[model samples]
Target chain A: MSTVEHTDRGPLSREEMAAVVARDIPDGSYVNLGIGQPTTVAAHLRPGSGVVLHTENGMLGMGPVVTGDDADPDLTNAGKQPVSELPGASYFHHADSFAMMRGGHLDVCVLGAYQVSASGDLANWHTGAPDAIPAVGGAMDLATGAKDVLVMMTLFAKDGSPKLVPACTYPLTGVGCVSRVYTEVALFDVSGDDVVVLETWGESVAELVDRLQLRIARATRPRGPGRLR
Target chain B: MSRTQFHTAAGGTTAAEAADAALSASGVASGMTVLVGGFGMAGMPVALVDALIRHGADELTVVSNNAGNGDTGLAALLAAGRVRKVICSFPRQSDSWVFDGLYRAGRLELEVVPQGTLAERMRAAGAGIGGFFCPTGAGTLLAEGKETRVIDGREHVLEMPLRGDVALIGAHRADRAGNLVYRKTARNFGPVMATAAATTVVQVGGVVEVGALDPEAVVTPAIYVDHVVDLRSTSGEEHAA
Candidate 1:
C-alpha cells in the first residue's frame, strides 16, 4: 500500500476524523468509546450496524448524547454525562459493567491517549507529574480488557513533539495492549509485526517515518476500501 | 442492627417514620468504611447520605467511584470535614472543587484505584473471596505497590477485597422485603456495594408491596439488603426537574 491522497480536501475536521474511525469498525461490532473526543464516534455510527455500546459506569445500547428534558440524571454514560437509552438498552452495577470491559467481551474500545509506544503500550491515565492528582477511571480496564484497543489522539503534542514514539515517557495505562493508533493526521496499524502506515492525511510515509524516528515497514497486508483516497 | 429491624421498627406505618427508623438503625458510628453508591449523581443515595450527615458520624473512610460531584451528597460530607480518607477511582472533575481543595491542602488522604479494580475488589469482598489476580492496572503506576502475578503468560496484579462498614445506595424501587430494582443507568454501584457492606442501606424512590417487584428483574435481592429508606414522598426536591 502507498500513501493515501485526498488532494481535493483541506485539513481533516473533528467529524471527519471520527468518520475515519467509524469506517473501520466492522458491522455488528461491540464497541466502547472512551470519554472526550472518542465519544464523538457514536454520533457517526451507521444505524442498524448492531454495534452495542458499553459504558463503564453501567450501560449497554447507550443512545447518543442528549439535552433538555431528554437528559435524565438517572440515565448517564461512563463520563457521568446525561444520555438516553436505545430500544435494547440494559444497565448493570459497576462491577459487572467493568467485568464486560475487563473480560475481553468488548470487540473494540477507542480511547484518547497522551502517548503510545511503538510496542503498543498505552499511557493515558496520569502524567506522573508530582502535582497532578492521579485519576485512572476505566482507562486501564478498557485498555487491557478490550479485544482490540484503538487509541484516538493527535499525532503530536503542542510542543511539536511526537506522541507515537519508541517508548512512552508518561506512566503506562497498559502494556502491549493497543492494536491501532487513530490520529488526526494519520491512521497507524500497530497490531502486527510492523508499524504499518494504514492511512495518512497530508503527510507522506517518509515524512512520518522521519518525524516519528521509529522503524517503519511497508504494508504486509492488502488495504481495504479506506475512507481516504 | 438486623435486616429484620426494617420490618419490626415502629410497625413501619409512614415513609418518614420508616426512613427515620432505618437511618437510626444504620449503626453509622464514627471511624467506619462507608461505601457510597452512584456514578456522579446517577444513582446517588442523597437521602441516606443526608441522614448519615445528620447521624453525625465523623472520620469516615468512603469508598466510591468519584470522590464527589457538586457540594451535595458525598461532597457535602467531605465539605463537612467528616471524611478522613477516600478510596475512589476519579476524584478530579469539574465540580470536584471540594475534593480538590482538601486533597491539595493535605487535609484528606486519597487512594486512587482503577474503576474496574475498585468494583471488583468490593465484589470479591462480597463474594467472600480473599483476592484475585486481575489484568487491569498490571503495568501501570497504580499497580506499583500491589503484588503482581503472571497468569496465562500475561502479567496481572493482585486485587484484594474491599468490604465496607455501611453501604449507602440509591434505587428506583424496592419491595418492603428490600429486593431492589434500580432505574436505567442509575444502577451503577448499588448492587455490588449492597453485598460488600456489613450493613447495606438503600434509598429508593418508592417502596412497593413485597410482590410488586418482579422476582426475575430484581437486581439486588432482599437477603443482601439490610434496610431500605423509602424516599418516595420526601425525595422529590432532591431529584428535581
Candidate 2:
C-alpha cells in the first residue's frame, strides 16, 4: 500500500488469470480448486510441481480431467465429473476427506466468488433468490478451513456493478476468510486490514478505486504465508 | 448358496420387489430413518433403493450426500412418495428434477447440513461421542441458532450425532464374514454409514470365501455389517481391480 503503481495493458484472458493463480501456488501445496473456473488452474500448473489436488469427494492425489473412453464412473472429482488419479492417489470415506479441510491440513483453496467484502468476507454459495434451489457443497468448509482462501472471479457483474464491495450484500459463505483475490482486471491482497492492489491489467489502480468507491493502495509487495510473502 | 450370498437379487415380480422383500425381512418399518450411501451415483445402492420404492414405506426420513439424480434410484423412491424428509449436504444437482419439483410443490422437507458436519455427525454417533465443536459453519445462516463457543481464537459450533434405523450401502466385494471392500471413490459414506445405523445391509458386486479376501484390504470389517445382498450377476467385473 504505497505509490500509484498503475498499468494500461489489456485485461488478462481467462487462461491468463488462471496462469497467474498457478504461478502463485507454491510447489508441494495441498490445494482444493472449486468446481468451475477454479478448476482451470490445474491445466496451468507446472509439470511435476508436486501440488497435490484434494477433491472433496474423497481423494488427495487427484490428476487431470478424463472424458469419453478414459472416464471411469467410480473415479470423479468433487464436481462429480470424471477425473484421473495420480501415482500416489489414495481414497478414503467422506468424513476423512472433509476432515482434511476442517482440520486445517490444506495449504490453499482457490474458489470462485460472487462478492467479497473489504474485510475479506465471502458470499459465493447463494444469491438468496427465493425461487432458486440452494446447494452449499464444500464451499463453507474450504473457506473456513484452508490456510489461504484465494478467490478467482470477474471484477464486475454482467450488469456492471462491482463485485468487490465495502460489505457484501449477498448471503455470506464465510466471514473474514479470503486472503487474496485474482480478477481478470487486477490482483488484490485482502489478507490484512487494507485491500492492497498487487498489480493491475487493462485498468489502473486509480480507475478501479474510483469505480469501486473504496480506498485501495498499490502494494509494495505481496504478503501471505506462501512464497509471494 | 453361501451364507454371504444368502439373500440374492432373485425370485420376485421385479428387481424392486425383490429388493423390497430384503428390506422388509430386515425389519425396515415405515416412519424410520434410513441412511442412503453415495456421492452422486458412485456408491449408490440402486437395487436397494429401487426396492424401497416397492416396499412402500411412506413417511420415511433419508440422509445422504445428494437427494436424487434423474428418475432412477433415489429419485424413483422420492417420486413414489416414500420419503417424507431429506437430510443431505447437496440436494440440488444438475439432474435432481424430482427433488426440485417436490420441494417447490411443498411435498418434501429438507435440512441442509454442511458436508463435513454431516459426516462428522454420523461418525460421532458411531463412536459414542455425544457432541463436538467445529468451525465449519460459524457466522453463516446455517449456524444461526446453534450453540457456539470460542475455542482457542476461533469460534466453533456444537454438532450432535446423527444415527439411522437402517443403512443401505454398495461395495465392490465382501467375504463370507461380511468384510467389505469398495472400488475407488465409491467408498465414500459407506464406512461411516455402516457404523451409524442400527442394521446395516450391503449390496456387493460378489462374495468371496472366508479366506479369499486379503485381511489388510477389508475397509469395513464384518462387525459393522448385518446383512449382505449378493448382486454378482449384474455387477460386472469392470470395477474389479
lDDT of 2: 0.86
Residue by residue across A1-229, what tens digits does model 2's lDDT show?
4433336568889999999999999899999999899999999999988999999889999999999999988899989999998998999999998898989999999999999988999999888899877788889999999999999999999999999989999888999999899898878888788988887887777878888867886666334322443
Task: Give all candidates' CA lDDT scores.
Answer: 0.84, 0.86
Report the C-alpha displacement of residue B87, candidate 1, in angstroms: 0.6
- Itemize residue pairs with steric clashes in candidate 1: none
User: How would you encode candidate 2's per-residue C-alpha lDDT over B156-195 as one tens digit per residue?
Assistant: 9999999999999988888898899998899999999999
RMSD of 1: 2.9
Clashing pairs in 2: none
| lDDT per residue (tens digit) for residues A1-229 in model 1 | 5646444545468888888889888778889999999999988888877889988888888888889977888888888788878888888888998888888889999999999888899999898888899898889889999998888899989999999988999999999999888887778877766677777777666767888878976554374325321
Error of 2 at A174 (Å): 0.8
Task: For candidate 2, give the lDDT of residue A39.
Answer: 99
Candidate 2 regions exceeding 4 Å error are A1-8, A221-229, B1-5, B10-18, B234-241
